[model samples]
Target: MEQAFGLVHHGTATVGGRSGITANTICCDVCIVGAGPAGLAAALRLADLGRDICVVAPLPGDGNRRWESLTPGAWKILDALGLGTALAQSHCLLSHAASVSWGDREVNRDGHAEVTFLIDRARFDACLMDAARRRGVRLLTPAVASRPQKIGDAWLLPVTTDQTTVSLCAAHVIDASGRKALTGSRRHRLSPATLALCARWRGPPAPPGVTRIEATAESWCWSASLADGAHYAAVFVDPRSLRAARDEPATAFLAAVGRSSPRWDGTLASPVTACDASASRIARAPGLEDTIAAGEAALSLDPLSSQGIQRALVDGQQSAIVVNTLIVHPERRRIAVAFHAERQAEASRRDSAMCHGLYREQATTYQSPFWSRYCGQDTPVEHQLRSPVPLDNLLPETRLRLSPRARLEDTAVIDGDLIALAPALVHPELDRPVAFLAGRSIGSLLARAFSGASAASLFDGWRADSLPEGTALELLRWFWQRGLLVDSSATDAS
Candidate 1:
């Protein structure tokens, strides 16, 4: 066996079956649906933890030719997955800047601050799938898996390939099958339904190393050059806007692209692909008794955040941990499920809030239906949005207390490679259950601060509690910014 990227090569994948509950059934510790980023990431992590992982993948070359710009942060996660050399070999294009024209402002960002890469999503996903296979994951390629049915303690998934159909019986299932998911029902719509019209171009060249994003009156458009020298442009708009030109999707795509950036017109290399770009989440808890939904199967965010792949990769790792806990420590199964559910909800809320805020800002500059729809009052935020109290307003003699809308709760959190219960500070403005910040426990910090103590007294107490020099003031600012801490006087006045 050859070793590549720290993975043991099992030569080539064969179309055979592994013995499961029955002789003909394929059995494993975990059955992962979809071979995209999330599923593959989970497969690799689960395999690392000494679990048998079976990944159901589409046939080779069966992915969309979408182009995505990977931030430096996203690249770090991919690199950790042993894709550094693979991506370089795939000729991923590195860019040093981006051009944005939005909200009455046009700015060019230089890569001196941070660099990014434009990658073909199809090739990127293939690289991840290959990496997972090399790491000893059993892959059912050229296969489609149906929704899993519970049988006894295992979930049985029916997989169909070109040759035959087989049953994959596993102790747990991780669903990462993208929008048309194989598992998990009851989805909650986060943003208004929107569609993306995308196509590849080969005629004209864009800036050598720049990605252009421009906002139009009724839609937003972006274009970037791929590693293979082809240019890609996409326009996102309301689905209803395209009903009139239903038969001419390509024409509507070109027209929409021209409205924002007219210079991007070029010879089409592929037909216009219209995909749902709306933000949504699985309303039901992602982790159930023996199944979990990772990546887009759990929560899909608006493309405006440019975090689709990043979130998928992160969820993969988290889901693996939750699954491991459910199987290894069955007594904590509920905690693991609730932890993953809360995390997904937190992600949905944070991403939706950011997207809505941006749309509202853009709507102020361009009065269009596209922007107006997101500015409405369908936000998922827990409580009414309130401005943060200024930290400078807190005097040394001023007393402080927790915000009325926030509280400390015993939350399930990730400890090492398992889910554990811990004290977390929860607030409507917060993205997740925050248990620690700046190496200090949130519960202890709050306990010392909420004792009717003055600002100076809190600071002195925190320092006495072994917080570093100037750490007390920084912690105070952090709380004030998140609206986790408020003035006692203000509460009394109200």
Candidate 2:
């Protein structure tokens, strides 16, 4: 690792004309501040591109167990890394069912289709770090990139360890530092406060073909049987609403588990651990100083979706591409940054809305401050979904206006507060939701589409990226139902 960084010793250093410690300065292509899953994944990919990489992180220990499951989307990355056999050898458990306990009844969403995997987060991460190391990733663990500085087009990071501090210089910086970004930039929290307490267990095989999800009076629980004859149980609750022994989280975890529906119960036998499993409140920010934050550092999803690991792996991949573009093709940096920002913002909205919907569905009858506050917002997932709209029934004299609450771009989602969409003229030559239409926002486009144009005339020349006759109407219906596209006269009358 030292050889890769081109380490050089400066025998003596003086500061303020006082005694100072020795220093070593090294240079690399890219420097990663976090060595967890996100950092390692990015390092592996960056190395594949033949980039010199240096990673500064704390040594992985018991903390890795906090990440236990991987949604199926992660398989592609594992396969690409040739870790499919390693993953298979790791005794990863496959779960076919995604069931939820809404109120008192249990509902299985997947009907037992194979999808999610339960693996040892500790082992999986260790394997990833090992793979990255083998690929020439210089890891300096038990070290901190606590502060990084930008000197011209390069980044200078100060890494501190027990023995000495090392200086790392790189052309680009990747902040895979999870939520506590090394840059100390704060993220916005979208949902009401929530956290998870998870514990491991050894138990009998769970019911075939399903992972059980349960919602209780004050919290939610998820228990999955692992491939290696073990099980994992996690409980989600608002810390304020929970008044349990902070020192004995295992007992609190057990008590919460006991309250869940009994369909997939397992005996709790391992020590419990608590961690923040909240969806990232921080929306993906525009690229700054060529530094990119990936995974939880970029956007943390709700655990209810169980897609964090997969998202992290994918985020790392995307971050690598972004970093590569910035270094290899500086002219394309603007395009790459825009794409990353849009993708991340969309993911954040999806996670927020899905979580809101999941909690809202469970709280329809039961009334509790815990659920009420988080589920109180309107979720736009159902609204964003494509459904049939009847543009054929439009009145020639009818006019439309963008809803006061609508915001648009090329890609759109229901943010907690307003509807977000991207405006683009659908054309036959374009891909789905194709190229950015300059100066287009949802409101302006909708206003122009129906402005003084007859219903037949509006539909006559419309070519929105290969929409079947009925599909276009459905898109309009989705917006109309949500009041994103409203009748001008009707709105004025009201």
Candidate 3:
């Protein structure tokens, strides 16, 4: 290994195998702060795009030992990141069952069992960072980066390593650092400030292959059996509840657990720990100034959602595309920034509503501050379960016209791995911006909907696009269901 400014360079692993240094200044295409899953994922994707990237942060596996439930969604993301095999080989606990006690005293079993895996977060982080390093991602470990300044088109980050400071410059920076992010200008708290008090224990594992989730007046608790013949439990509560009992947090923690559920009590194995579990998001645009925040840095969701690692990996993948777009097409900077910001906001809103919905269910049973504060006030976007206008019953000659609320707008969309501006059909009634339906451009069809179009004529006209025989009608039904299409007779009657 060659050492440059205290950075060890593995042979054949250089930026082609040398520290990216010139006159003591390290320069790269992107600089990622924080070596967590988010930062490492961004580094891997950026490397795939042929961009020289460097990750600066302290050594991995340094955070408090915490466990995460890796749902099937998280598994898919890990597979995309090429860590699926690694996860399968790891000593993760394969849970076959999970039960929830919310809204009422009855325990409800999850329908989908045998897929979720409980994993040690420290081990997972090590695996991801190792994969990134092997992919030729430059890592400046045991390092700390000061505030970065945008000089010209590059960000100058002062990194301190081995008690010495070195200037690392890059065209863009990724703040994957956790809640206390180093880049995002502001954080918007979506719910009440909450704290999660967790305790790790070693004892006769609570029945094998089962995870328990319950809610009570004091807090909500989650406890599960571990692969190491041990078990762990966590209770989430308002931070204010701990002010008086600050001197002996373990006592308060155990009391909260007992109130939540009797199954969580166990022999204490590690010091009780507390972490922020509130829902929040970056107030500023995600890709503003070419500096993007990923993972917890961009959006932090409540642990009740069981989506922490999943959200972090998703933010990592999306931020990579944003950075790649800004580099490949600087002219499309506005489009890229808009895409990132919109996506971040959309995820925040959706997850926030889902988590709040869960809390809302329990609030019916436990009318406490913890539940009341999380009971979501904002409504989620409505979704249609059944089509209002049935295409099967409509005659071929049925005349349909576009709803006045529907229009075409240019929007930035994910084109493969990059952001591209495309004309998407937008409507006040549509759940999401629709660019295409069943491989057919909604724009081309909507443009013809200006005047009333017969169902037969529309299908025949769009058949040239080679859509399957019934697909065109199905696409029309999609619009009709969303109120983007209205019957010509209804228009005449009104």
Name the candidate that leads on lDDT.
Answer: 1
Q: Give model 3 RMSD, 1 decimal.
A: 4.6
Q: Per-residue lDDT of 150-211 in model 2, one digit per residue for the tens?
A: 66667677887767777777788888888877654567766766778887676657554346
The local distance difference test score of model 3 is 0.76
lDDT tens string, model 1, 33-95?
A: 988888988888889899999888866643248888777777888788777887786557888
State the C-alpha lDDT per candidate.
0.78, 0.66, 0.76
lDDT of 2 at 228: 56
Model 1 earns a TM-score of 0.82
Which of 1 and 2 is ahead in TM-score? 1
TM-score of model number 2: 0.72
Report the lDDT tens digits of candidate 3 across residue range 40-128.
88898999888988999665443348887888888888898788887776667778778788887666565466578888877777788
> Where's the lowest-lDDT run of ten residues in candidate 1?
1-10
Ranking by lDDT: 1, 3, 2
| Least well predicted 10-residue stretch by lDDT in candidate 2 | 412-421
Query: Model 3 residue 205 lDDT?
Result: 56
Task: Give the Å shift of residue 73 in candidate 3.
Answer: 1.9
For model 3, the run of ten residues with the poorest summed lDDT: 8-17
- Greater TM-score among 2 and 3 belongs to 3
TM-score winner: 3
